[model samples]
Target: MIGIIGGSGVYRAEMLEDCKKEEIATPYGRVSLTVGSFDGKKIAFIARHGEKHSVPPHMVNYRAHIKAFEILGVERVIATAAVGSLRDDYVPGNIVVPDQFIDFTKKREYTFYDREAVHISMADPFCDEMRAISFKVLKDFEHKEKGTYVCIEGPRFSTRAESRMFKSFGDIIGMTLVPECQLARELGMCYLCLAMVTDYDVYGEKPVSNVDVKRVMAENIERIQRVIEQMLKELPEGRSCRCSRALEEAR
Candidate 1:
C-alpha cells in the first residue's frame, strides 16, 4: 500500500475512490487515516496537521503518523508540505522534490527507540527511488528536483534575519518534515517530500505578506492536484530500495 500525508489546505485527496476512514491505534498513539483506491491501487491518506488544520507543526504527533502507516502495510509515503522559498530559484507556486534536508527543530520527540537507545542511520534521509519516481511523474511541471529543505521549529514564521541565515545554507524552508522524515526512515518506509513553495520568506525585498498564501495556493492548486494524480498513476507496487531495511542495524 502507498501512503500519502497531506499538508495545509490539502486535508483530503479528491481523487480517492471508495474512501473510508479508519482509526488506528499504535504504540505511540491513535491516528485516523483515510483508506481508498486510486487507479486500482490501495492508498492511505492522512492529514499531518489534523483534519481541521488545528494542529501546529511543532505539536504534530509524528510518531503516531508513521506508526499508523506501518500498521496499514504501507511501503511508500508521498508527503506533501507547504514551504517558504529561501533561494531565488525556488520561487513561489513551484513544486520541489527535495533531495537533502537540514533540521533546526528543538525539544521535539524525534525518535521511537528512546527506551532501547537505538540509532538509525540518516546519511541519505529521503528515499532516492521514490524521489526519482516523483520527479519523473512531474517531469513537465515547473518543479525543482534537487534542493535542501530546512525544517524549522515553528508555530511562527521566521524573521528576516533568520530567513536569510537559513537561506545561506538551504534552498527552501518549512515547519514540518524533520522528525516526520526521520521517523519514516526509522520505520523502514520509503519517504519523499512533495514540497509546495508558498512564499519567498521575510528576507525577500518584497516583504512577506499574509496575502501571498492564498494567492500562491490558488495559483498552484490545479498543478498540485495533477502532480499527485500523476504520481499515484506511476507509483510502483514493490520497493527495490533499502528504506524497508532501515531497522536492520538498529540496536
Candidate 2:
C-alpha cells in the first residue's frame, strides 16, 4: 500500500473512496490513521499535525509515524509540506518536488538507530522515481522539478537575517521533512514530499506573517489536491530504485 502524509491545511483527502479513521499504536506512541482506496489501490493517510493541525514541527512524532506506516505494509509515501520560498524562481503558490534537502533543524529526534550508530546515506534523500512521477503529474502547473529544501526546527518563522542567510543553502524552506525524510530512508520505504510554497519567508520584500502563510496555502490547496490525486492515479507500480534496500549495507 502507498501512504500519504498531509501537512498544513491538508487534513484529509476528501477525494478518496471508502476512507475510514483508525487508531494505531507504535513503539514511540499512538497515532490516528485514515485508510482507504484511491483508484482501486489501497492507501493509508496520516495527518502530520494531527487531524486538527495541533502538532508543531519540533514536537512531531516522526519516528512513530514512519513506524506506523511500516506496520501497515506501506511501500512508498507521498508527503505534502507547506514551505517558504527562499528564491525568486520558487514563488508563493508554486508546487515544488525537491530532489535535494539540507537540514537546518536545531532540535528533533533524527533517527531510529538508538541501539547502534547507523549512518544511512543522505545522498538523494527523496525517492527519485517518486520525484519524477510528481513532475509529470504537475507538468502544466508552476512546478519546479528539482530544488534544495532546508528543513528548520520551528514553530516560529525565521528572522530577516536568518532567512536571507538560508537563501545560499536552499531554494525553499520548511519546518518539517528533516527526521521525516531521514526516518523513511532508515525504514527502507520510498519517500517523496511535494513542497507547496506558502510565502517568501523573510527574503522577500514583504515581511512574513502567519496570516499571509495561511492565505497562500488556502488558495493553492485545491490545485495541490488535484496534483496529488493524479499522482496517485498515474504512479507506476513495483521497484525502480534503491529506496527499498536502504538498510542493506547499514544493518
Candidate 3:
C-alpha cells in the first residue's frame, strides 16, 4: 500500500474514494490517518500538521506519523511540503522533487531504535526509486526535477541572512521534512518529497511585503493536487526497490 503525507495547504486529497479515518497506536504514540482506495489500490493519508493545522513544524510527532503508516501496512510514503525557493529558477507556484536533503532541524526524535542502537544508512535520505517514480509523474507538469532541500527548525520563516546562507548551501528550504524523512527511513519505508515552492524567502528584494500564504497556496493548489493524482495512477504494483529490504540489517 502507498501512504501520503499532506502538508500546508493540502490537508486532504479530493480524489481519495471511500475514505475512512483511522486512529492508530504505535510504540511511539497514537496518530490519526485517513485510508481510502484509488484505482483499486489501498492508500493511507496523514496530515502531517494535523487535520486542523494546529501543530507547528517543530512539534509534529514524526515517529507516531510514520509508525501509523507502518502499522497500516504501507510500503511507500509520498510526503508533500510547502517550501521557500532559494533560487530564481524555482519560482513561487512551482513543484520540486528533491534528490538530496540537508537537515538543520534540532530537538526532534530522528530514530526509532533507541534501545537497540540500530544505525540505518542515510547517505541518500530520500528513496531513489520512489523519487524516480515521482519524477516520472511530475515530468508532465511544469516543475523542477532535482534540487537540494534544506530542512530547518521553524514555526517562523527564515531571516534574510539565514535565507542567503541557505541559498549558498542548497536550492530550496523548508521545515518538517527532517525527522519525517529520517523516521521513515528507520521504518524501512520508501519516502519521496513533493516540495511545493510557495515563496522566495526573505532573501528576495521584494520587501517581503505581501507574500500572501493563502494566495500562493491557492494558486498552486490545483497543480500540486494534479501531480499527486497522476502519481497515484502510475504507482508500481509491487516493490522493485531496496526500501522494503532496508530492515534486513536491523538485527
Candidate 4:
C-alpha cells in the first residue's frame, strides 16, 4: 500500500474513494489516519498536523505515525511539507523535491532502535526512484528537481541570523522531516518529501508570517495534490530502489 502524509494546509485526501477513518495503536502512541483507494490502488493518508491544524511541528508524534504506517503494511510513503525559501529563485508557489536534508532539530525522538546501536547509512537519504518519478510529474509545473532541506525545531520561524546560516548550505527551510524521514528508512520504507515553498525565510527582506504562509499554501494546495496523484499513479508495483535494503547494511 502507498501512504500519503499531508502537512500544513492539507487536511484531507480529496481524491480518495471509499475512505474510512482508522486509529492505529503503536508502541509510541496512537495514530489516526484515513484508509482509502485511488484508481483502485490502496492508499493511507495521515495529516501531519491534525485535521484542524492543531499539532505543532515539534509536538508531532513522528515515531507513532511511521509505526502506524508500518503496521498498516505500507511500503512507500509520499509526504508533503510547507517550507520557507532560502534562495531568491525558489519562489513562493514553487515545488521542490528535496534531494538532501540538514537536521537542525533538537529534542525529538529521531530513532526506533534505542535498545541497540544500529548505525544506518544516510549517504543518500531519499528514494531515487520516487525522486525520478517526481521530476517527471513536476515537469508540468514550476519546480526544482534538486534541493537541500533544512529541518529546524519549531513552532517558531527562524531568526534572521539563523536563516542566513541555513542559507549557506540549504535551499529550503521547514519544521519537520528530520526524524520522520530517518525513521522511515530504518523500517526500509521508500520515502519522498514533496516540499512546497510557502514563503521566504526571515533572511529575506520580509519577515515570514503564519498568515502569509497559510495564504500561499492555500493557493498552491491544488498543485501539490495533483503532483501526488500523478506520482502515485506512475509508481510501478515493485520497488526498484535501495530504500528497502537500508537496514540490511546498518550495523
lDDT values, one for every candidate? 0.88, 0.89, 0.85, 0.93
RMSD of each: 1.3, 1.0, 1.6, 0.7
For residues 135-214, could you state the per-residue lDDT of candidate 2 as single tens digits? Answer: 78988899888889988888888888898789988899989989999999999999989989988898787877889877
Over the stretch 1-251, how does candidate 3's per-residue lDDT look in tens digits?
A: 88999998889987899999989998889998899999898999999988888999999999999988988998889889888889989988778888888999978998888889687777778888777877788776778888899999987778788888899989988888898887888888999899988888788776332355556877888888888888888887987878776778766
lDDT tens digits by residue: candidate 4, 110-146: 9999998888998889999999999999999999998
Writing each residue's lDDT as its tens digit, candidate 1 over 196-232 gives 9988888877766657765787677777877888888
Model 2 misplaced regions, further than 4 Å: none
**In candidate 2, what residue range of length 10 has the lowest lDDT sum?**
201-210
| Cand. 2 TM to true fold | 0.97
TM-score of 1: 0.96
- CA lDDT, candidate 3, residue 174: 88
Number of the top candidate by TM-score? Answer: 4
Q: How many backbone clashes does candidate 3 have?
A: 0
Better of 1 and 3 by lDDT: 1
Top-scoring candidate (lDDT): 4
Model 3 has an lDDT value of 0.85
